[model samples]
Target: MIESWRWYGDLDPISLSEVAQTGARGIVTALHEIPYGEVWPSDTIVARKAQVTEAGFDWLVVESLPVHEHIKRGDGDLSELFANYRQSMANLAANGVHTICYNFMPLLDWTRTDLEAPVAGGATCLRFEAVRMAAFEVHMLGRRAAEGDYSPDVLTKAAAWFQRASEADRDALLASIMAGMPGAFDRYDVAGLRVALAAYEGIDRDALRQNYKRFLDEVVPTAEDLGMRLCVHPDDPPRDILGLPRIVSDGDDLAWVLAAHDSPANGITLCSGSLGANPINDVPAIAAQVADRIHFAHLRNVTKDPDGSFEEAAHLEGDTDMVALVKVLLDEQSRRRAEGRADHTIPFRPDHGHHMLSDLGRDMIPGYPLIGRLRGLAELRGVISALSHG
Candidate 1:
């Protein structure tokens, strides 16, 4: 496997020099400055590549070239958006950046109710409590149909939670749930969130899947022609949330996605932490089954509760068997090597680590503190080393 690290460009508090020290040679990133639905200018790609190269790292994969909201909703004149996305793929390929990671989730990216949930050892990790999310959806956002989405038990817990939450607690909950992504807080508010939810009123799971298929049909060919790979990331929690449809959540969804385009260029980003959030998903089994189609991997773990809540666990300590998953991926790599495939080595990163050591006091991005991820990378690297030699 090609060990990689996700760097959020110049503005990221963690510098490339710092990332280099973590012993990761591949940099997984994206042109986040480019707005959704816009073409990534060639010069911008070159400049970013130059930065990574200068720092002694290869621009291995584009963590995401975001899919526009209009495209996901199948709304408006999508011709221009599709054209722009194809052009972006072409531009990325032109720059020798072939592997692209993206997601088709509508409106929001990966979400968590508590960005700084306290864990053992005085460290903090990202957490998603189902009841709190329900509280936000029903009592806070006051979505018209939010009550129907949760079970009666959850609704009761949510109601109790909402009633007991103080004004400050309510505000914090609202802010955390509403926070879209890093640097995206300004884009979403209660009114805007409601409007976004309203736009998806009629689009259910089937419609969203169809829309995703339409997207693949349009761009996968371009990716193949460019010798580029497009990998769709699984849903963060692997379930429906905020009254919106979640199409890519589990193994079946992954199977459908790969079948949608059935090309080497069309693939999936095997995100263990995200997929493992749902206990039903056997993370190692999924890795082995989709070994050939997994273009990239996010190796992290989460401990799930019976009530649908989960918190980030140490890479090796979570419910998912990290060592077994690594062994499966390594075995796949050996198979690809025997088959004489050029893209044999899979690129992976240690995702969403706990804020520990010096990372505790820093005002870093929620789950992306420097020390935490460095620790995760070191641990994952150790596992790969032991498995390969053992």
Candidate 2:
């Protein structure tokens, strides 16, 4: 694996020089300055690439080239949006950035209920509690029919959780879920959330899956044309949230997607933290199945609770067997090497690290504190080294 780190442009507190110090030679980033569905100017792409190059790092992967709400909802003028996306792909390819990672989760990007849940050893990590999410949906967002999705027991627990949550807790929970302010829920207010929820009111799982297929059918050809790999990120939590549909949660879901286009360009990002949030997803098994088509990876682990809550754990100390996963990745790398594939060495980042060390009390991007991710990278490097040689 080619180790990389995610950089959120100029506003990111961790400078490119700082990222280089962590021994990450590749940078995984996107144009957060550009709004959703807009064309990323070639000038901007070139300038950004130059910035990374100057920092002694290669811009190896785009963490995302967002698929806009207009496309996801199967509403509005898709032709214009599709054209813009295609142009962005062309611009990125022209600038030498070939792998693009994106997600199709509606309304929100990877969400969590708590951004600073205290963990053992006096550190903080991101967490997703199903009951708390349920509470947000039923009592906060007040999405109609949300109560029906939960079992009687879970609903009862959710109600109790909502009752006990203080005002500050409620605001924090709302902010955590609305991270990045994905277009559909950009306003981040109750009314805006309701409007966004209403847009997906009639769309069910099957409809959403069909919409995802349509998106691939239209975009995958362009990706292949530009010699770019489009890797779809899995839905975080890998389950329905706020009564919305999530199709890319499990192996079967990914298999369906790979089958949709049957091309190498139609690949997966394979985020372990997102998929592992649901205990049912076997991370190593999924890695094996999708290894061939995985263009990018986000390798972090999660410790899941029986009540469906999960906390981001250290790289090697969670529910996932990081060593086994690394072994499989190494095997895949060997196979690719034998095949003489240029992209044989996959690019991956130590995702969602805990807030620890000097990063404590600093205003930093949650899950992306400098010292914690450096620790994760060091831990993962040891595993990869041991597995590759042994």
Per-residue lDDT of candidate 2, residues 40-71 (tens digit)? 99999999999999999999999789998878
| Model 2: colliding residue pairs | none
Provide TM-scores for the models: 0.97, 0.97
Any residue pairs clashing in model 1, and if so which?
Answer: none
What is the alpha-carbon lDDT for the whole of candidate 2? 0.88
lDDT of each: 0.89, 0.88
Model 1, 93: alpha-carbon shift in Å?
A: 0.8
> Per-residue lDDT for 339 in model 1?
99
Task: Find the number of clashing residue pairs for candidate 2.
Answer: 0
Which candidate comes out best when scored by lDDT? Answer: 1
User: In model 1, what is the error at residue 258, expressed in angstroms?
Assistant: 0.6
Q: Which candidate number maximizes TM-score? A: 1
